[model samples]
Target: MSDCDDRALIEAAQKDPLAFGALYERYVDRIYNYIFHRVGNVYDAEDLTSRTFFRALSHLADYQDQGYPFSAWLYRIAHNLVANWHRDRSRRPVIALDEIVARSLSEQHPEVVTEARATMRLLREIIRTLDPVRQELLVLKFAEGLSNAEIGKILGRSEGAIKSLYHRTLLQLREEMEKRERGER
Candidate 1:
């Protein structure tokens, strides 16, 4: 559904709780994927996804249309919950590159599959070493496929800031990957 459709659903849901089910159906998978990528475990992702929707449903009355998609609000809620989850556990974020790699790999060649998995594992490790903001940027950009503007809204930054951060993040990832290659040698 388009953002306009989501806005209308939000307005309707604000009036009747049953209407919120449609909104939840529309976004549940995307929100789950976002949370899953951030937390890297199915159980925590499922728990957090439930909490995110529950919070959104409870706060639906206060939702305002600020020209951003309803998903942005949902994402903001998910982001906060994930942050708190990490803070409480004192654990670093772990992007599940295995799923991502598996999806992208062709099963035609055993050697290629092994190489791709190894590369993805290395990338995942490097991503975990990045600070939270950069890791969030990567997840929002690649994992969620959100545009810079949407990410900016979720992160509370300008679009230009998101662009700059994305650029620097790519550079940093490249440098880290290079360092890993050198160390392996």
Candidate 2:
């Protein structure tokens, strides 16, 4: 949807809770996928996704455009909730292998699937080792397919900063993967 369409939806939703359902329908999958990646499980993802929408609905009246997409506001809520979830658990993040495998199963042969799964597992492990901000950056940039500008809005960084961080992140991932390969040898 265009920014204008989203803005209209937000305005309508703010005036009527029922209108918020349209906004929810537009964003639920994206938000759920994002939460699912962060929490690594369906149950927690579902819980957090619900919490995100509820919070958004409750605060809809307070929302101001600020020129960013509505998704940015929703993402900020998800990010804060995920942060608290990790802090409360005192554990490193995990990406569920089954979820990854399931998503890829339809398109690849078994052998290719195995290789892809292994690669994704390694990447996820490396990603978990990153600071939360960097991890969030990767998820937003790659997993969610957000543009650098969109990621910057959600991450509270400049678009240039997001570009630079993405470059550095790829370098770090490459270095980490090399270290892992050398150790395996």
Model 1: worst 10 consecutive residues (lDDT sum): 93-102
Model 1 reaches what TM-score against the true structure?
A: 0.92
Clashing pairs in 2: none
Please report, in order, the local distance difference test score of every candidate based on alpha carbons: 0.89, 0.89
Of candidate 2, the 10-residue stretch with the lowest lDDT total is 97-106
TM-scores, all candidates, are: 0.92, 0.92
Model 1, 34-58: lDDT tens digits are 8998899889999999999999999
Q: Give candidate 2's whole-model lDDT.
A: 0.89
